[model samples]
Target: MASLRRVFATSILASVLSQVLTATAQPAFGVCYGMLGDNLPTPAAAIQLYKNHNIGTMQLYDPNPEALQALGNSGISVILGTKNEDLPNLASSVEAAKSWIDAHVLPYQGVNIKYIAVGDEVIPGESAQCVLPAMQNLQSAISGSSFSSVAMTTAVSGTVLGASYPPSSGAFTGDAKRALSGILQFLSNTHAPLLINVYPYFAYAADPSNIRLDYALFTAPGPVVRDGDLSYWNLLDAMVDAYYAAMERENFPNVGVVISESGWPSAGNGNFTTPQLALTYNRNFMKKIVAGTGTPKRPDSHLDGNIFAMFNEDLKSAGEEQNFGLFYPDGTPVYPIFS
Candidate 1:
């Protein structure tokens, strides 16, 4: 036992020194914490969940100081966002934006709030047009605040891209390009990753047979697809590399990519393993990303993902899939996912 312990310790140390060795061995995620359900656990309880589980990150749908207060003093980083409806408001009223920051974020200094996600999943609707100006205004708002190293980014729904198969032929829709160029330029300049709300479940639901279940679930797959010199074994990389390719088409290939929201619903009765599949997808995907990786094409880059939600919100639009919880409303994990 002592010899085994020594070997494991040495392996961890060597991995930190050699990037390639660590690329496949890193454990855990940086957390994707969301609270939108009526069956919801309180924010305070949720913060305790992070502490008990040794989590290090939280992705929020909006700037809720109650949640920040819940996480007070925890080193876990936060990524807060502006709602889609607030885009026009943010674009039109810089004062309102400032007021929001002062009220929502200013009171919570000496806390672990990390990133400000401005206008989440705003790239697909009529609000897409407002995204650019909203981003500019939010940047100004963040700059005006005392929060340092706190990044400002936007979330784009996967629908922004027109083609995503083969991973390399990815490109944004013609209309989406003109509408989003300004925001893209801003992100490129500011050095923020393109935060995307990716749902491979949608891809599988669109066609399950063509998409292998194991690949989506991150289980050991049949074989890697050798599309010429490029290779892929899972749906997550295919979905992400498409973004890389699309961004490359737009001449901003180096901009970072982050999975701002990605998870399986714990119990979607009518759909594919809504919650179970969600757990599987997140478990395998998070393990891989935290290990420091990208698609075979972008292997040097480490992938960063935030799981979709924290609670199985019964109040979230009355949809079954809205219950995308790693934990039940009472703070018990729905599944014993950890080894």
Candidate 2:
């Protein structure tokens, strides 16, 4: 009897130890390493930057040879973009789009080149008429190419969804529904992520009272607004759920939606939110994201989001928020996002 009791106690301790080790040994996470800054490090050095910091993935606005060669074999998946100017040309010629991919995308196959974004924020307006053509051309190019597994899609603005505040009320704008529905059909046919960019910062700025600061910052939630079993405990999930609803309305509800851009700016329009607060917002949220905390709606979905700009661009055209970087230009650590 004494021997059996001792054996049972040992088994219990071993099980407890196994659980603790499993929790501790979980991999850190991934992030988007953007190079929007003028004084940013060379692509080679930038590769080293994320490597040292333990970032796993990155997104490039364009598939620059410098960046591709640098990130090649670094084990980082690259998200390439189409410049707005190139849109008109790409739209006009499928051959040009194919050639562009051959030159820019083909070479990086085994090393990187995960997705080729058709263009950014195209919603078919007076300004966006030039973009959809590029999308059609790019899609054609991808279809003809051997690497269709490399996702061929575009990143759309969260604003495309008319009302995002309440997740259920989300839908595309009047005319946008037609354009967006087509885009969704393309995404559905081709297995690609939605790549939706959500900014809770805009929500907080627009109406601080109605929107909880903690919720917007993704800090900690109190008793949150519950809509049946579909409760939104915070802004991030709320924004994501809105995307889910939009996708559902299009009948491609199972389609993947990734957070293409989501982070807080340290300083901005009036600087009401403190630098520390900004750091807290980004650092904490990223930590949670990397820890595999999916939105309330999609618990099993990959929450591995790509945060905005890797380095803060000092010459960022305008406002301070436009800077939107994880690091300052001169290789100085703006804040310890992981620590």
Candidate 3:
């Protein structure tokens, strides 16, 4: 254990030292700014934190007024989301979608809204029926205007996959297959990427006996899984490739993918959640992204993604959900992810 800690310390030190030479470089990835904690820093302060770290992109779970205000003219690329509960209303009436855009988006002219996610992880559930229509209405609302450049899409969890093993065999399940067909078509038509939340930590925790820790943490020294000519050294790439394969099987072969959320918990279950593991996973993940190392399936593609959250949300459900933050609510980093 001491040797392992020393290895982690050495690897982190090397990464931090390397970052000093590239302090001004724009980060290739983004972090989700979730506001579910009472002790969280103000939106302005949070925006400053992102600037201080040279972060160039962010994902907001919803259009919080203060956050959007803070983002105005800040020059940070944003992926703004709509509340799942609002989907029914937005889907039912194009006027409701137009009103939503008029209220939450148009006023913030300085904000760089890259993508507007209609709903989050509501697929394969009660609100699943509302997703495609809401996206259509929102797209119509934003058409032929400055906001037209802002892509329309929705975020879905990895559970939408029926099979993921071998990466190439990935396919959507029965329910998700039926529901996502039209949505996928819409995404392809609009040239928007499908946003997915991929968590190797959860995959490993659920079946540590089968999933290796090194594989999940991006520390595996050699290829652990070989799929035809492709080799997967880490779980992230494999998971991403699986999603791509699934999309291809769904007949949306050209639709791109953007990782909506991914992170490890700093504290929760005994061994599976720890500061060391969280730091390792996030730092390595960022490095992989910064290097523009696309997954084997999309070797030349420039992948876009966001870390799960900026700060720990104390108000979240107890355990892993609350612990997926890169920083504490007090504005201090839970681990030195930014160096």
Candidate 3 has its poorest 10 consecutive residues by lDDT at 12-21
TM-score of each: 0.87, 0.85, 0.95
lDDT of model 1, residue 261: 78
Point to the candidate with the largest TM-score: 3
Candidates in order have lDDT scores of 0.72, 0.69, 0.88
lDDT of 3 by residue, 16-107 (tens): 63574286467778899999998999999999998887777899989999999999988799999999999999999889999999999999
The alpha-carbon lDDT assigned to residue 242 of candidate 1 equals: 86
- Please give the RMSD to the true structure for each candidate, in Å: 6.1, 9.0, 2.6
* lDDT agreement of model 1 with the native: 0.72
* Residue 59 CA displacement from its true place in model 1, Å: 1.0
Write out the backbone clash pairs for model 3: none
C-alpha lDDT of candidate 3 relative to the true structure: 0.88
Ordered from best to worst TM-score, the candidate numbers read 3, 1, 2
Model 1 residue 139 distance off true place after TM-score fit, in angstroms = 1.9
Overlapping backbone residue pairs in candidate 1 total 6
Identify the leading candidate in terms of lDDT: 3
Model 2 poorest 10 in a row by lDDT: 12-21
